[model samples]
Target: MDNMDFSSFLNFNTVTVAIAVILLILLVSRSLQRPANVPPGPTGYPYVGCIHLLRNRNILEVFRELRGKYGEVFGLKIGPNFTVVINGVEALKEAFVKHADDFSDRPGGFLAEVVFKNKGIGFSSGENWKQNRTFSLSTLRSFGFGRRSLESRIQEEITAYLDVIEKQNGKPYNMKDMTVMAVSNVICSITFGSRFDYNDVKFKQLTSLFAENFRLSSVAGAAQAFPVVRHLPGDLFSVKRLVQNFEDIKEFINEQVIEHRNTLDKDNQRDFIDVFLLQQTKNGEENPVFDDLNLTTTVMNLFVAGTDTTATMIRWAILYIVHYKSVQDKLRQEILKVVGTSRLPSLADKPDMPYYGAFITEVFRMGNIVPLAVPHGAKKDIHFRGMVIPKGSFIIPNLDSVMTDPEVFENPDEFHPERFLGENGQLNGKEKIVMPFSLGRRACLGESLARMELYLFLTSLLQRFEFLPESPDKLPSFDATLGLARASKDYSCRIVKL
Candidate 1:
């Protein structure tokens, strides 16, 4: 071979060596980038990143107990997933309030994708979520949710509840079905333009189905603990059952949708379904975002949100009022003072009914429904507190700790309504430890509607009947149980007519 041929071969070899060196450098840089700014967490096992901790739901409490060892901000593992939990009131305030934007997006996971389906305002992200969330708020406002105009629906509902209780004839009656039925029925008027009787088997079936689906969703179990297992069909987990429930829900919604479409009046729309159908007709199948699926999910979302939270809270409210008769008397006095005995109390009387208002707020704070709210995630990389919580890291803001913080409330555990009272002996509104509706951009869309219902129903009932335990030896059980939100375990209460 000639010298020129040898030089060409040597040049080719040198270029190849240079390319290999550059590739090696790039690999190292990519590896270092991941661990960089990643919040500190306990070392997790392979494939099941944090699945082990999730298998043991007590991990949250364990972390709290071992805070001295791991510190306030620590990591949780479920398979390959990483979650950064925020403990105590200070941490909650800092993350949820101070750094609200950074940790704003709702977290996504196996259950989030398959079970929740990321459709409604609760779990969805991006433009779809913002539009739906905004529309829900606007619709609630259009209905006069908090204002006097909206008070008519609440007044009607309140009348309905009073009538139901009066029909019991002051006998010992389970308030759960009655409470849920009445609250859900009011929402029915608002969302479906129809009401179902408490004794109606179909209504019971619907509620039962929802409850069963909720019960199957073990947010703290193997499916949530290990994402891989969630997609798999094995009785090693109930993931298949979870998928089955979703299909069941879809079928039920389809039946309702057919009925709704059959009788829907596009010209004068009333319920939420009517509004959505109108939009669908206007947009058509060509419209990608809005469709029948979205409508069913959105309406179902409204019904579930309204029914579950309001019914549970009302049950708690009565439990507390009965347990503390003085508070009940004060509330009744306030109601009578403002509205008198002739007509029932309504949302119009809330401002004058400060004591009543404070009592309800106290119900929220005291009850402490949903100890830790549905976890949120970081849309983009976020630098918060003293640690760096990476993008997609599951963030748990322990709302339970925040509500019961000693620094925030005078007596954290006690059922005290006066804590919300001002120096003027009215609702202070400050020292606001309660956050049952959640906070910031993702706050509850039905907040105003729920508030109106709570005020009207609670105050009106106090004016008419007094809630009491079934027997002198019996007190309403305060055991907390889970169904996304915590409520009195085996949730039951009794009532008496005035």
Candidate 2:
């Protein structure tokens, strides 16, 4: 053995290799560490556990049923992982606000690390997460998210959307493609100093790719739930596709940055890429986290989070308006009264338009696109509401139940905009109850932009046209299938220009 060189074997067992193994085992061990006193929930099969709960078509329904039996905070066994979900508003508040610091992190999902390639704001953690998130929130504000300047951009996009529809001339149309493109342009303006034409093949492909990935099933959730599934052939195939999608998106953004860099004035930075390039210039070579890779990821994060979520919300808004005639009539009357026929409604007018605002608020509730606010991770163990949310626990505010909580909202399931309007016909206290933008530190970074886009676009559309379902039998399915975001199956309508 000594003659065969004992040092070779020792050298082969490198510290880096040992550390890598230790970290991998730690992440693996996370699936096993259920808290001693978790919120009560249905029992599941051992090891493989309630992962089966998420496997089939009825998973969202399964979750809804679980919410019924378990009240608000309840556990669900997903393979070896036991996630404690805080459903309903009170429980959501408790988890999000009262104990916010404990739960203000992106969950340690195997999919996030692998799929995001641990890139920027959406998945990355620590100092980079803080800087990027803070910068994003701050930048959007400065660039007029809910402010007047941003309203003009939204109006421009809406006009573009209207122009396409007006060309159709009282035609039965699937506005889904145009809707996503309109919203994507808003983000493009913010992120890259540009917007895509609605017919642009690239825009369609990106939107479709993102939508497909976001609406993944619970079997995929189980694979995400348990990292071991990641190495399996099928999981790796899907992930490779997602990564390839990201590469396509990144390649486009990277080229845009180079073009911007040649013509850019650091002081007169027009858009997000410009701002980021300036940051890179400022940070210089010492910059570790704010490098080009992270910059691209941040731009992608804005595009992904900012684009589809708002588009889907607005699509759902139009769907709901078409689904309910009375609500549609009320909205039209409000639009006629507040906005008038000639010029479109602006962000400044959001204050004067109470019914319109309330309708938008209810749209957010009824849409329920993100049923669970993106899962948060426990930074450290802390006692929250007589329960210990242990360190590194996967924490989720099940916002679906929050919006539907009967106590706070009267007949929470009903699509009544009046719920958001007070006794004197003003915007009501319901927004405080609505957590669509979520709450606390990890709340959606694009909340203001989303809110502005929803209100202005929805009001503008109603002002310009009356959206009607194709027939009485044509109510769009409200069954929100589970994914990273909830998406409706399909719905088409005819837009009659008023």
Q: State which candidate has the highest lDDT.
A: 2
TM-score against truth, every candidate: 0.84, 0.87
Which residue window of length 10 is worst by lDDT in model 1? 28-37
Candidate 2: which pairs clash? Answer: none
- lDDT of model 1, residue 338: 90
Which TM-score value belongs to model 1? Answer: 0.84
Q: Highest TM-score, which number?
A: 2
Compared to the true structure, candidate 2 yields what TM-score?
A: 0.87
lDDT tens per residue, model 2, 1-498 = 794577777776786699898887886565444557767777776567776676654654676788889867777666666677877767777667776666677766664676566668987777788888887777777875433367677778888888888777777788876787788888877777766777778777767766665554444465667667666776444655565666787888788878888998865768877777777788893686778778788888887787768878888888887888898898788778876887888777778888877887787887888877777776677676677766666777777776766777888778888877889998767676777888877888888888888888888888888887776677677766545567776677888887
Runs in model 1 deviating more than 4 A are 1-37, 40-72, 78-80, 87-94, 97-101, 145-150, 219-221, 231-237, 491-494
lDDT of 1 by residue, 348-392 (tens): 677797787788877888787766677788777778765677777
